[model samples]
Target: MTERKVIWNGRVQSDMVDYNGHMNDASYSLVFSESLDALMETTGLDASGRERHAYTIFTLEAHIRYLQEAHEQQALRTTVTILDQDAKRMHLWFEMENEDGDTIATSEQMVMGMSTTTGRPGPFPEEVEQSLSPLPKLDREHWPTHANVQMGIRRK
Candidate 1:
């Protein structure tokens, strides 16, 4: 099983707080999006790499769960795990933690590679694929407790 890697680190800004006096839901999505961008850069899909290879990654789906409230100015760190991947797509899990190490939120996303020329899902370029090859993959048995959870009201 691969270890979770810290991808993004920042504090909750005043603008990110909602009327509820805590970080807004939209801000959580924003943070996760930034984390995805970091992942892209790590895998050599950054701006220059994308331009050279005419390839980019797109979010196909995302699920976010807010576990705790975050106040403005609170430091936050996002860690990511590569749950699964193929030539054209990846399933990622990200966890947002407070300074004290409490999980504030989690995001699970499925992203796909697209050829800029075709504007459709396509396999990653050879260089990007090679870059991604080094990232540790999480075995199914080692997935986090929050991974792959079904969302619905629990009725007993």
Candidate 2:
């Protein structure tokens, strides 16, 4: 398995907290999403590039595990791992952690390439594929091996 790849880092805003006084579940999704946005840039799948090819990625499924809570103003970071990929889709794992290196949450996602103009599923362009080739191979072991991860959103 490959080591964690830090994609984005930031602070937890007080506004992101819920009534329970910690970062809300939706915020975790946002963090994971923003991190994925960063990775997309690195992988040659960003907005301009996708638009140029008339294709983009759509999330097919997502699974998250809340291990620990994050509070307001806490410095945190997200690490992403490309678990698997093919011409049409990519599977990824992400971890949200506090500055002290504790995992606050984990998310796994399956995203598919789709034609922007026609909105039909399609494979990535060769240029995009070539750009993503240099990234490390996906390894499931990099994520928690035994946890029961499933597709379903959870409310904090």
Question: How does each model score on lDDT?
Answer: 0.92, 0.83
TM-score of each: 0.95, 0.86
Clashes, model 2? 0
Q: Summarize candidate 1's per-residue lDDT along 41-98 as a digit string, tens digits.
A: 9889889989999999999999999999999999999998889998899999999999
Q: After superposition, how far is residue 130 of candidate 2 from its true place, in Å?
A: 1.9
RMSD of each: 1.3, 3.9
| Superposed Cα RMSD, model 2 | 3.9
lDDT of model 1, residue 97? 96
- Residue 80 error for model 2, in Å? 1.0
Candidate 1 residue pairs that clash: none
Candidate 1 clashes: the total is: 0
Q: Taking the tens digit of each residue's C-alpha lDDT, what string does model 2 give over 10-124?
A: 9989889999999999999999989878887877778788878998888898888899989999999988777788888988878888999988888888889899898899998
